[model samples]
Target: MRKLVMVSMLIGLGVLPACTRTTNTMGYIVDEVLVAEVKPGIDNRASVEKALGKPSIAGQWDDKTWYYVSRNTKQTAFLMPKPTEQSIIAVSFDAKGNVASVNRRGLEQVANVDPVNDKTPTLGRETGVLEDLFGNIGRFGSAGSAGGPPQ
Candidate 1:
């Protein structure tokens, strides 16, 4: 009986490591060699696409700028994934479609945003729960109250 308990303990110990935090790579996988080949004034939109594939995201207002973003995140069990590393390559295009500039950014640019909780303030008078439940009562006129429509 002791040997059986020992063997089960050993198996549990071996399985514990499998539950450790896992690292995930999300978004574009950048290749330094391909990125180096993209030169301003030489590479156009078509050439850049061929070299780097489709960008992770583009300028929201226009197509003049493209961004290749890569991030590594680590998560444990059911917790939210936290960023371990992040990289962004922004390529801007001139009006003629040629590459105007290439900029590289790292994790320092990331912003942490915490949204406001609870009720959202709106332009209206506050009312209790009971008022909300019966507020619409008697709001509509009776069908006979209109008398005889337009004379």
Candidate 2:
């Protein structure tokens, strides 16, 4: 019986390592060699696109900037994924279609934003709950009954 328990324990120990999964990756996989070929001020949009392909995200309002984003996450078993590595390459262009700058950002630049729940103040007369509930009671009338139109 002791030998049986020892064998079962050994089997369980062997399976424990398999339970943890390998790192998972998502988004664009940046190649340093390809990125290096893009020279600031000299490389234009066409050349950059040819070298690095289309960007993951472009500037929200315009095409003046492009971003290549990549992230690597790891999770063991049922735990939430934690980002182990992240890369964001930002490329900006001038209005004339020439490369203006090339910059890189990491995970440290991520921001956590929490939205406020306060109602927006508007220019109107404020009314209490009872006034609001009964305010429109006598205001609504059928246009047909008022001789405006026929249905």
The candidate that wins on lDDT is 1
Best by TM-score: 1
How would you encode candidate 1's per-residue C-alpha lDDT over 1-151 as one tens digit per residue?
9999999999999988867899999999989999999999999999999999999999999999999999999998678888889999999999999999999999998888666786576897999999999997777665656643343
Candidate 2 total steric clashes: 0
Candidate 2 per-residue lDDT over residues 70-128, each given as its tens digit: 99988887786788899999999998998999999999976665556766657989989
Clashing pairs in 2: none
RMSD of 2: 6.8
Quantify all predictions' global Cα lDDT against the true fold: 0.93, 0.88
Q: What is the TM-score of each candidate against the true structure?
A: 0.69, 0.66
Off by over 4 Å in 1: 1-18, 116-151
